[model samples]
Target: MKIVESHKTDVDNYIITHHYLRSAPAGARLRLWVKDNSDNVIGAMMWGRPTARTYDYNRILELTRLYLIDDTEHCAESKALGMARKYIRKHLPEIRGLISYSSTGEGHKGTVYLADGWFAVGVTRAAAWNKQGRKNIDKSQKIRWVRSV
Candidate 1:
C-alpha cells in the first residue's frame, strides 16, 4: 500500500464519517489516503493542529484520525504511518514532530504508534463535567505517543 495526499471532500463521506470513530474532520491541515496495488482506497489519515495547547504548538501536529479497511493483511497501518512521516518531512518541513493518541475506552493501545517507533508519553484521563441540576462526570483515557519528523 501507498500513502497519497488526499482532499477533505474525497475522504470525509467515503472514509472518515463512515469509518472513523469521530465521524467528522475538523481543523484538518492534511488528509491522506492509503491505496492498495490496484489503487483502491483502503484507509485514510488526518493530521491537524492539536486542540489543546502544547509546548511546541507551532511545530507539532496531531494525527487525529487513522482508519484502515478491515480484512487487509498485516502491516498496512505501519506502512501508512511510515509513508505519512516521510510525506510530512518532505512536504511539511516546518513540522518537527507528530503526536497521536490511542483511547483505552476504545480498547486501543497504540500498536501502530509503537510499531512506528513513537515515544510513549503515558496515559491521560479526560473528564467532562455536566451540570444538569446535579453533577455528572464523563471520563475517558487515552495513551499518547510522539515521534520526531
Candidate 2:
C-alpha cells in the first residue's frame, strides 16, 4: 500500500461513510489516503489538534480519524501510519509528536497503534460535552497513545 496526500473533503467523506462513528473530524491539519498497488484508495487518516487542553497543540497532533476498508490487506493500517509519521517528520518540522485515542466503548484494543510503536500513556476519564452543545456524546473512557514524529 502507498500513502499519499489527500484533500479534506475526500478524506472526510470516506471516513463518514466507512468509519464506525459515521462522522468526520472537527478539524484536520493533514489528511492522507492509503492506496493499494492497483491505485484504489483503501483507507484514510485525519490529523489535527487534540481536543484536550492538556496537550501542547503547537507541537502535538492527534490522529482524529483513521478509516480502513474491511477488505484491506493485512497490516495496511500500520504501514499507512508509518508512512504518515515519516511524512509529518519531513513536511511538518515543527511537530514533535503524534497522539491518538482508542475508545474502549468501541471495543478498540489499539492494535494498529501498538503495531506502529505507539505506547499507551494513560486512560482519559469519561466526560460529557453537553456544554459544547453536542448531545449524545460518546463518554466512553479512552486510552491515549503517543509516538514521536
Top model number, TM-score = 2
Q: How would you encode candidate 2's per-residue C-alpha lDDT over 52-131 as one tens digit per residue? A: 88989999999999988889888889889999999999999999999999999989989999999999999999875554
**Tens digit per residue, CA lDDT, model 1, 1-83:** 88888764676655545453545446788888889988988888888897558546678889877888886669789879999
The local distance difference test score of model 1 is 0.78
Reference-based TM-score, model 2: 0.92
Which regions of candidate 2 deviate over 4 angstroms? 129-136
Q: Which ten residues in a row are the worst by lDDT in model 2?
A: 128-137
In model 1, the clashing pairs are: none
The global C-alpha lDDT for each of the candidates, from Candidate 1 onward, is: 0.78, 0.89
Q: How does each model score on TM-score?
A: 0.86, 0.92
Q: Residue pairs in steric clash, candidate 2?
A: none
